[model samples]
Target: MKLYDFPLSGHAHRAHLFLSLIDVDFELVAVDLASGEHKKPPFLALNPFGQVPVLEDDGFIVPDSIAIMVYVAKKYGKTDWLPEDPQQAAQIQRWLSVAAGQIAYGPCAARLVTVFGADFNANEVIARAHSILTLIDAELANRDWLVTNRATIADIALYSYIVQAPEGNVDISFYHDVAKWLRQIEALPGFVPFPTSKAGLRAIS
Candidate 1:
């Protein structure tokens, strides 16, 4: 299996973390997002949308972070990553949706605007981001992980951006529950840190 990804991308990091947690042996193909390599011809052939974290297993290509997580968990990981019960699966899906929707809009989008200098209404986005964070903080006030008693793809999907919220100038100090949750995720076995600098990003690239 081959994973084409940009290290700094949280979405890509989710897949990488999942593979590591499952002890899957695969090739890491760095996509140079800094040079617009993801949009270039050869890379676009892998994913028409030109996104990172494209998983190629035996010539089968899977795009999107959620899809990759599901594939890996179902194919390689323990059943805990993806439960069998319909209610349990729906609970996991709820958090995954939160990661894709509110979390993306808040921490992820804010980070891109601040770090990559992307043109976006920071004030408006930050407002939305804080609302999401506050909601998450409250939800996590009495829980450790997102949806399950233990770690799951739902936690992995949301951890990257939420943990790095400080880098985007979104203060996480008030969210003590989130801070604690971040620590818990980090303590998980096979945990990998998200890229924090241009050099680290280049190394992953």
Candidate 2:
């Protein structure tokens, strides 16, 4: 498999991280977002939306980072990342939705403003970051994993942006449970961290 990736994208990080966790041997093809290579014909042939983290397994192309995680897990990882129970499956889907919506609009959008100079309302995104973080913090208060006894795709789905959120001026210092939860993910085997930018509201100890 060849993973077309951009180092700075948290979306890309999720795919890369999960592949590593599953011990899949794949090649990395760096996509130059700076030069708009993703929007070009060759890349667009892989994903119409021109997104990075597109996985090419043989001739099969899978777009979207979260989708890549799901595909890899279903084909290779199985019960390790996804479970059999209907309730657990539903819970995982819930967090994946949060990752796509709240986390994307909140921490991810906020970081985009600083890291990529994206035009977004920093105050609004940061506030949304906190609102979502508070909920995640509460949920994590009694558990290490997001939806199960061990780590799942749901945890991996939310891991990158939430951990890097402080870089977008979203302070995470007050979310004690969230902070501890971040540490737990870091301690996992085969864990890969998202690159932290120097900008944003870093948590103060």
Candidate 3:
């Protein structure tokens, strides 16, 4: 298996972490976003969206971070990463939706502004980040994992940017439960981390 990746992308980090957690033997192929490599024909052939973190298993290609997680979990993760039960699946899907929507436009977008120089209202996105973080923190107050008794793709899908939200100036110090939840994920076997950036108010080396 091969993962077309970018070093600083949370989306890429999620896929990388999940693959490592599942003990998948895969090679990382860095896509040079600085050189427009992802926008070129070769990479575009793999994913027309021209995004990093595209996965290639044998001849099979998968794109988008969430899509890649779903595919990998279904094929390799069994019940741990994604449960087959209808109710559990629905619960996982709810959080997955938050990952794609709220999490995307919130902390992820805030970080994109500072880290990538994206043209977005930083204050607005940061506020959105806190709002969702508050909700997630509340939800985690009574649970260790997001969807099930064990960690799932829902947790993996949401882990990266939330942990890195401080890099976007979204203060995580106030969300004790969220912080604990992050530590729980970190304690899992084969865990990998998203790189912390110097952008925003908080800095991590």
TM-score of each: 0.93, 0.96, 0.97
Segments in model 2 whose C-alpha atoms lie over 4 Å from true places: 202-205
Model 2 / residue 110 / CA error / Å: 0.4
RMSD in angstroms, all models?
A: 3.7, 1.7, 1.2
Number of clashing pairs per prediction, in order = 0, 2, 0
Any runs in candidate 3 off by more than 4 Å, and if so which? Answer: none
What is candidate 3's lDDT per residue for 51-138, written digit by digit as tens?
A: 9889999999999899988998888746878898999999999998999999999999999998999998999999999999989998
If both were scored by lDDT, which would come out higher, candidate 2 or candidate 3? 3
Taking all chains together, the TM-score of candidate 1 against the true structure is 0.93
Instruction: Compose the digit string of candidate 1's lDDT tens values, residues 31-123.
Output: 999899999999889899999889999999999988999998888747898988899899899999998998888888878876778777877
lDDT against the true structure, each candidate: 0.85, 0.90, 0.91
Per-residue lDDT tens digits for candidate 2, residues 1-205, read 9999999999999999999888889999999999999999999999999888899999999999999999999897478689878999999999999999999999999999988899999899989999999999999989988998988999999989988887898878889998888888888878887876677665332
Best by lDDT: 3
